[model samples]
Target chain A: MGETFKANVIDHFNFWVAVVLMMIGLYAMITKNNLIKKLIGMSIFQTAIILFYVSAGVKDGATIPILEHHAAETEQVEAGEHVEGHPVANHEAHAINPDDYSNPLPHVLMLTAIVVGVATLGVALAVTQVIYKNYGTLEEDEILAKIKAAENDG
Target chain B: MIWQFDIIILIFLVITAVISLRVKDLLAASMVFGTYSFLICLLWAGMGAVDVAFTEATVGAGISAVILIATVYNTRRDSSD
Candidate 1:
């Protein structure tokens, strides 16, 4: 029983860390008052999701997705045994197995996500600067208060 | 499982997160946030996601931090909400 618990911990530890990061980011986004801190929280939240994806793509003992030239040669040698010494016959026949390397799809998608995140952070911070320029404050409530005062005056 | 290293990184992440959020100074918080992003990059790289780590490091740690510090530069140093 104890062994199974330990195994579960080992296997899913990365997931737990991602979850914790997500929660921390969420908490900050909800509770923090400063605009920059909220942006930081949003960035943290994004990174946690990226971490979850990258960790999910990990496989034990898996190499990078790029295929080596020798892989086909080695595979042909292993497959040639059953063909009665016909060593080079199926050189171009067998396809590379998918299990030998980590998945690249998630990595590709996260590349886009990270770019979007940076862009969004930049835009959001620019907006924060604008808010401060107009209202002389970055706090959400203070901005609301200024808006209300302008409304009342106008 | 290399669980020890992962746990240690996670601990640092949590510590930085709490400190970054709770700190009073916006500049200090932004710096701590950059540290958090960097730690996340390390965690991703250690998990064999080199591409993701690269993106995180460049965007999260580098570009995002610069943009944030610039925003802080244009705004008040203290939050009053």
Candidate 2:
């Protein structure tokens, strides 16, 4: 009990919260019957993936990965001042390096994921429209009933 | 304040999930789930993952919700008894 908890050094609150949400989303997906609810569950599930990717890409005390801020602020910066691509020192005392920049790769990949998600959502919504049209009802059970009735009649 | 905000956001996530599930109405569930996604995106931003936050805001909360609402509109509105 006297030992300093080494793992305590890591701030794990964010990770835990993300995980709980993820589990909730997963459970919702698995148990929900309504197709719309299932889609919502899927959204939550995708949210967990988004959180995981972002969490994985995080660095301590980092900012947005976008360089859009650099272009507008540089005019106010003096010569040899902190600027984009400027040489800076590392966190270590007297160690030479560049200012730690946020990781941009995850942002790029997430952008792709966002676009894909939207495209897929559009296609899915279109399909749902069709599913609604053919059956004259959107209830999954009703659709199944109709299919079964049709089969029996035939 | 930051820690408190994060904590509240997290608690809201769980509560909303449970409430969404408990509600018999699927539209309400989808709306609540969308709110949940929005909160999670903010939580991501708090973690300095701005890109993920943006994606979540756009895709998770936007496209997904739109699709779900479309589905709900096309399908039945209430839970089956």
Candidate 3:
């Protein structure tokens, strides 16, 4: 049991680190009073999740998702040799091994997530600025207090 | 992938995340968060996700940080907690 645990820790170090980062971000988001701080924490949390997905897609000895064009094949095509079709077609004839390239699905998904995170950040910051404009402060508690006072007055 | 490099970058990532959250200066924290993004970009490149790294470098570290700094400048610069 001890040996397996050690091996797992060594093998999945990235996952463990990602988990720690996620927790740190969560803590900041939950505890920080400043609106900007909470946004920063949200950014960290988003990045941590991206890290986890990218790490999951990693394969040992795998190159990037892009397929390498062999010089010989390109030369043949350049020499007016009638190529059957695109490079992927030729790869299919040769039986391309999926393991040779890192998984692209996770990367693509994370790309969308990153864009969404940035958009959310922008919108949240805009809202935060408007809040500061109205409340004269960015602290959550201060804003709450102001709202309470306004309610009592009303 | 080089495990040693991965370990180092991940450690830096966590440290930057914590520091960004802990810092009193909001601007400094935003800068630290940018650093965290760049580190994660490096991690992605090392993991053979070059395109993702490029996107992260341009969007996450560059555009996002710039907007964050802009927001910080427009608002308060210090954090109470």
Q: Which candidate gets the maximum TM-score versus the true structure?
A: 3
Query: A1-97 in candidate 3: lDDT tens per residue?
Result: 9889878987799999988988888998999999999999888888888889999999999988886677446655544434554444453445457
Q: Give, for candidate 1 chain A, the lowest lDDT window spanning 10 residues.
A: A86-95
Candidate 3 C-alpha error for residue A2, in Å: 7.4
**Candidate 3 residue pairs in backbone clash:** none
* lDDT of each residue in A21-96, candidate 2, tens digit only: 7787788668765555555556556656665666677675556655555544543453344456675543244332
Off by over 4 Å in 3: A1-6, A71-94
Question: Chain A TM-score per candidate?
Answer: 0.81, 0.68, 0.82
lDDT of 2 by residue, B1-81 (tens): 156777688788778767776788778877887887788778877766677777778877887777777777776678652
User: How would you encode candidate 1's per-residue C-alpha lDDT over A71-154 as one tens digit per residue?
Assistant: 778776667675776556565556686776888888888889999989998889888888888888888887788899999999
A-chain TM-score, model 2: 0.68
User: Which of the predicted structures, 2 or 3, would earn the higher lDDT when compared with the native?
Assistant: 3
* Tens digit per residue, CA lDDT, model 3, B6-56: 989989988898899989999999999999999999999999988889999
- Residues B1-81, candidate 1: write the lDDT tens digits: 255777888789888988888888888888998898898888777766778788888888888777778887778777653
Listed for every candidate in order, the interface RMSD values in angstroms are 1.9, 3.1, 0.7
Task: Give the per-residue Cα lDDT of candidate 2 at A28.
Answer: 67
